[model samples]
Structure formats: structure tokens, C-alpha cells
Target: MTDLRQLRHFVAVAEHGHFARAAAAINLSQPALSRSIQALEANLGCNLFDRGARNITLTAHGQLVLEHARRLLAGSRALHNAVSQLGNLQAGELRLGAGPYPAARLIPIALGELARRYPKVRVQLLIEDWASLRRRLLNENIELFVADCRELRDDPLLSVEPLRVRPMLFFCRPGHPLLALAEPSAADIAAYSLAATQLPEDGARRLQETLGREPLPDIQCDNFMVLKELVRQSDVISFAPEDVLTSALVGGELATLPPREVLPRKGSAYGLVSRAGHSLSPAAQALRALIFAGDVVAQ
Candidate 1:
């Protein structure tokens, strides 16, 4: 029976400690504000205020009601704000995940655009391998993720939307021995240490077949930056999406190995992944649009 209006009146009176001043602050006449508070107290069967000769104070019951009223009002305001944000994309959060390659190559550009367009929308990005990202998405830790989705394409629990495919390339430091060979064989390249992030299942199988050995990087790292530095300083060869190697290649810090018959020139099958049948929030939708747009432009 008690309503928000009555609670507001009660809070105003409690905060001001004077009926006249509280009524003036709320643009209500003193008698009307008093009646509202009286009705609230009557509905709850308690005296919220103790009226004295010169000052008014909250009784024990009044203090308890004030705490509950503040919390309720705060929750109500948050609900209204969330509703408004859903319509306008003016404020909200986007929880996103990305595989190492997409995190390093694709996400930054899209996130930059998202930041410029919706400054109030908060973003939380988790960079991991595709399998880890899949777990996070299924657990509802992230609303969506961008990653190599070849393995997830047939997953009933996921919805995958393909992005522009990017060619993968192997690179080594400029003066590496592999670069000296006019045409390096898979065995020639594999003679030295290999470095990379976690490979997808198919990629691992192909590498194992090509090298005729175990498909494991001698120097495994999740971060490309670290892998790049390692390759630049050592005889380690590494592979990554072409875009991720652009800077190093352009600067001549690294050079790609000549395409070998044994090694396939496979491109990444990256996509946007989300839980099946789950709707994205407005902020997530906005970022998703930016990501798709950026992917098109990158092509």
C-alpha cells in the first residue's frame, strides 16, 4: 500500500529534519508533505518521526525505513537508466572475448571506433585461445567473442558468424638460415625452434603432417608480442595471421618463408561467436556492428 511518492516524501523530511523546508525543497506544500508521510506511517503502523519542541528526529523505525527506502529508490533509478540505455546505446557494458590473433589484429580497431562512438559504454575484453574463449562464452562470462571458429561452426550450443578470412604466414628474423634457402621445405623450417600460440586442432594436425613430427611449438606463448620479440632475437620461426605480422614485415624485422609444397597456405576462419539463442545487449550490438564493418574494410 505504501508507494514511492510516500517514501520520497518521508526521505525528504528525514533528510531536512524540518517539514516546511522539506516541502519547499520538493515543491510541495508543508501540509501535503506531512499528509504523505503520515499516510506512509499509518500504512506501516509506525511513527517515523518524533516531533519535539524545536527539532524533529527519526525514531528507530524511521531509521530502518529510511535505509530500505534509499536502497529501493537507488534500484528503481538503476532500472530506469538501464531501460533508457537499452533504447539509445548511450550507456551500458560490452563483455567481449577474443583469440590471440583477433585480439592483436582485429579487436583494437573495432574497439577504437566503439570508444569514439559510445564513450559511456564500458568494455571488458578477454584475450585467450579459441578453446578458452569458447568456455567463457558458454559460461556467460562474455556476451560474444571474435576468434577462429572452425571448430565451433558445428556446435549446437554456439552461433558463429564468419568474418573476413585472413591468410596465415610463417616468419623468421631477417637473416635466419631458412630465408637463405630459395625454397624451404617443411623439414628445413622445422629444423629450428618453432614458436606460436596454441594451435587449433586442424592446424596442429596439418603441422604434424608437414613436419613429420610432433606439432608443438618449441616456444609456446599466448602473446604475439612476446613471440615476435623471441623470433627477432633467436633462430625461432613463428606463424601468425598476415595482418599481425604487417609491422614486423614492413619494418624488415622479420621475413616470411617462401611458400613450401608441404605447407598449406591456409587462412584463418575467424568469426563472431555467441551462445545460441542469446540476445546481445545494445552496447554489444553496437560493437558487433563496428567489428563487422571493420572486418569488411580490412578486406
Candidate 2:
């Protein structure tokens, strides 16, 4: 049976490229560390290293074993973390991913509630586009994410639960020319350059249907902050979920165009998405529950 300790020793040696340094790192005598590596190679019936007088390098077989060894060690660590956090949400870490819009609007409230409840629990959030968040979740870089449920539906590896429905609204800085119009046609809105957040395909379809045509935004950004800034400075019309501009709206920096009645409330839904079959840590689950409870599914 291969010992995990021996694998650790091998990894340390491979990383350091010197037995003395590796032994120091692992707090073992050089001879003991060397013996451990020898035992590992002997058990596998192969020379795991091309040991030279100056430095050592992994042999072809060593490289193969190193990859698997690293994976095994990583899995072991994950298992240990899961076990440690099984029932203890007070001290463990919670890692979450979200797109810019959700990160800006919904996450702050849920996170605030989480912090109020479990002050010791550490929370890490990654904000990016859906594609980036999806990749991070698939890689286990994050425990879960809040994003477009539509994107999560296409991937078989992810489990999704709908959290909130946010309607799309055309907005602009206060006193923009569009606000003067009682009911602006699609062409009227299209006449001015617009900036908007990147929408999923379904969201794009909905927007097109609402506009009665496919109106291409002059600036398409995944980050809502960028669109908000563009709308604030330039005459560019901003189009995105109402939540994305909640702060700006509250601060009186931005306002919906063509009146609230003209805006389409049939917008996108965001959800809690995690890798299928992967267990979340206790802190993560706690945060998820908090967010779900607070989400409230807008009418």
C-alpha cells in the first residue's frame, strides 16, 4: 500500500528539487526524507527521480505519478475540510461566485445577514462574467455561484435553484432626453448610443421581443458598473436589470426611461448553481439558505 505521507515527501522533494530543502520544508531529517522517497519508488518498482549531483528532476514515471499524487492529495484535503465543516458553520470559510449584476445588488444584503449571524465565518466572493463563474464552479474553485439560471440549465454538471427574477429596464442619467418622451419607439431609443450589460441568449431574445427588433448596444459590458459610469457621463442609454442600477436609482443618479410602465418586467432569473454531486461546506450552505430566504422572487 502506498502511504500518503510518502507521496507528500515525494511532492516536497519534487517541488524543492533538493533533498535537504525538501526535508527542511517537511521538518524531517534529510536521510529520513530520502528513505521515504526510496520506499515510495521501490513500492512502485520505478526510479521516480533523475537524481543528479547538482539537482534532481522527475523521471517520466515520476511525472505521471506526481500528477495523480497531487490530485489525490487535493481530494484528501477537500475531504478533510468537508468533514471539519460538516456541522460547524461558525468558523469555516464560504466561497461564492457571482456575475457583476448579482454581486452588486443581491449579494451585499445576503452577505450582510450572514455576517450578522456568523461573524467568525470567512466569506470569499468572486465577481465575473457567467462564463468565468461557470469555469470556476466546474473547477471547484468556488463552492457555488449566483448567476443566470438559463446558463446553468445548459450544463449537465451543475445543479441550479432559482433565487430571483429581475426585470430589464432601459435607464439613463437624470434629465436625459429619453425621459421627456411619453412613449419612445424602438427606433427612437435606437437613435441614441446605448450601453448595457451582457445578457444570456434568452435574455437577449426577451429584450429583442420587447423592443420589437434586435437593437444592438453600442457598448456591451459584463460589468454593470461600467455601463452605469458610461450612462452617467455620456448620453449613452443604459439597459440592464433593475437590480443592477438599484444603487444608482436610490442615489438619484439614474432613472428609468420611457416611464416604468413601458419597461419590460419579463426579464432574467438568477439562481444558486453548484457542481452536481459536490457537497457544500456548512458555511456555504448557511449562506445559501440566507440568500434564498432573502431573495423573495420579485413580482
**Which stretches in model 1 have alpha-carbon errors above 4 Å?**
1-84, 260-262
1-299: candidate 1 lDDT, tens digit per residue: 99989998998999999998999999999999989998999999999999988779999999999888876765464455457568667876677899888888789999999899888877789988888999867655677999888889999999999998787888889899887888998878778888888877887777877887785667778887888999999999888888888988999999998783455536878899988996776777788899999899887
Residue pairs clashing in model 1 are none
Stretches of candidate 2 exceeding 4 Å from the true structure: 1-77, 205-215, 259-265, 297-299
Residue pairs that clash (backbone atoms under 3 angstroms), model 2: none
Worst 10 residues of 2 by lDDT: 259-268
**Model 1 TM-score, all chains together:** 0.71
Summarize candidate 2's per-residue lDDT along 103-154 as a digit string, tens digits.
8778888899889988877778998778788877765667888877776686
Q: How far is candidate 2 from the true structure (C-alpha RMSD, Å)?
A: 5.7
